[model samples]
Target: MIPQRKLSLLSNRLARKGGRRVPEAVLERDYCLSWFLVGLSKTPLIDILAFKGGTAIKKCYIPDYRFSEDLDFTLRESVPFEKIQAYLALAFENVEKDSGIKIRISRFDQNVLGLTDLPDSGL
Candidate 1:
C-alpha cells in the first residue's frame, strides 16, 4: 500500500513543477485504477479483458492527456455474466488485500460494474 504521506508529497512536487496542474484527487484516482489493473492482471480474466476508454488512452498512449475518473474494459471473448462477476469480485478482493484500497461494486448491470472506493480509506 502507498502511504498517504508519500502520495501527498508527490502531488505537491508535481503541482510545483507542472503547467497542466494535476490535482491530488486525480492522482489518487489514477493510483486506485492502477492497483485495480494489477489485481485484474493477476486473474485469468486478463486474457479476455481489454482496457479501453479515456483512462486507457491516458495511461498507455498519452501521459499528458486529460485525467479520467473511471475504468472501462471490453471483453474479447463471449463470457458468461456470472463468471465475469466472479472474476471482478476476486479482483476487488485482491486490491483490498494487496493495497489496502477497499473497492465495492456500487452498481451492476449486464454491461457495467460501477466501483467506488470506500469513504473511510482517506485516500
Candidate 2:
C-alpha cells in the first residue's frame, strides 16, 4: 500500500511543478491501475501479446515515462474474447481485493481492432 503521506507529497510536488492542481484521486487511480497491470503481466496470457504505446511504456518499460491514459497491445494471433475477459476478470479481482481499490473492466466499442476499453474506475 502507498503511504498517504507519500501520496500527498507526490500530489503537492506535481501541482507545484506543473503550476496547477493535481487531483489526488487521479494519482491514486493511475497507481491502482498500474498495480493491476503488474499482476496482469505475470500471466502467460499477456506473454503472447506484444505490449505497446505510452501506458505500456509507463508500466512495463520506463518507470519515469510520461503519464498515459490508456493501455495498448498487439496480438500475434486471435484469442477468444471470453478467455481474455475471464483472465482479466480474475486478475482484476485479485488486484482489487489486495489493494482495496476497485477496478472495473468493461468493453466499449470505442477503439479499433481488439483494443479493450477500461471502464471508468469511479476513482
Candidate 3:
C-alpha cells in the first residue's frame, strides 16, 4: 500500500494542476501490473522494450513527471501478434478487475501496444 503521507502529497500536487490523482485502489492495481511486467521481462517470450511513465520517469527522466498510472511495454519483433494481444487483454482485465476501473488496450503495431483508456469507474 502507498504510504498515506506520500499519497496526500501526490494528491495535493495533482489538485493544484487540475489533474486527477490516482486513487489508492488504482495505485494498488498499478503495483500489481508492474510486478507482472518485471516477471515477464525475465522471460524469452517478449523483449519488454520499455516500461515508461511514472517508473521510467523516476528512474530515467531528469525531472520526473511525478505521477503516472499506465504501464507501457513493447513486444519482440518475432513474437506473434496474437500472443501480444492475448497478453495485453489479460493484463488489462486483471488491472480493471482489481482497480474497479475499465481499461482499454490498443496496439499501434504488431510489437507496440498501449493502455489507451482507464475509466474512472468500472463502467
Counting clashing residue pairs in each candidate, in order, gives 0, 0, 0
Ranking the candidates on TM-score from highest down gives 1, 2, 3
Candidate 1 lDDT over 60-116, as tens digits, reads 899767789988888888788899999999999999889899988887745544344
For all predicted structures, in order, the TM-scores are 0.77, 0.67, 0.41
lDDT of each: 0.83, 0.72, 0.55
lDDT winner between 1 and 2, please give it.
1
lDDT of 2 by residue, 52-104 (tens): 89888877678666777666766666777777778778777777776776678
For model 2, the stretches where C-alpha displacement exceeds 4 angstroms are: 1-6, 15-22, 109-123
| Rank by lDDT (best first) | 1, 2, 3
True-vs-predicted CA distance for residue 14, candidate 2, Å: 4.0
Candidate 3 structure lDDT: 0.55
Better of 1 and 2 by TM-score: 1
Off by over 4 Å in 1: 1-5, 109-123
Expressed as tens digits, the lDDT of each residue in 1-111 for candidate 3 is: 457777677667756775566565655555555555544444443454545566566445644355455555544344666776676666556545555445564435333
lDDT of 1 at 29: 80
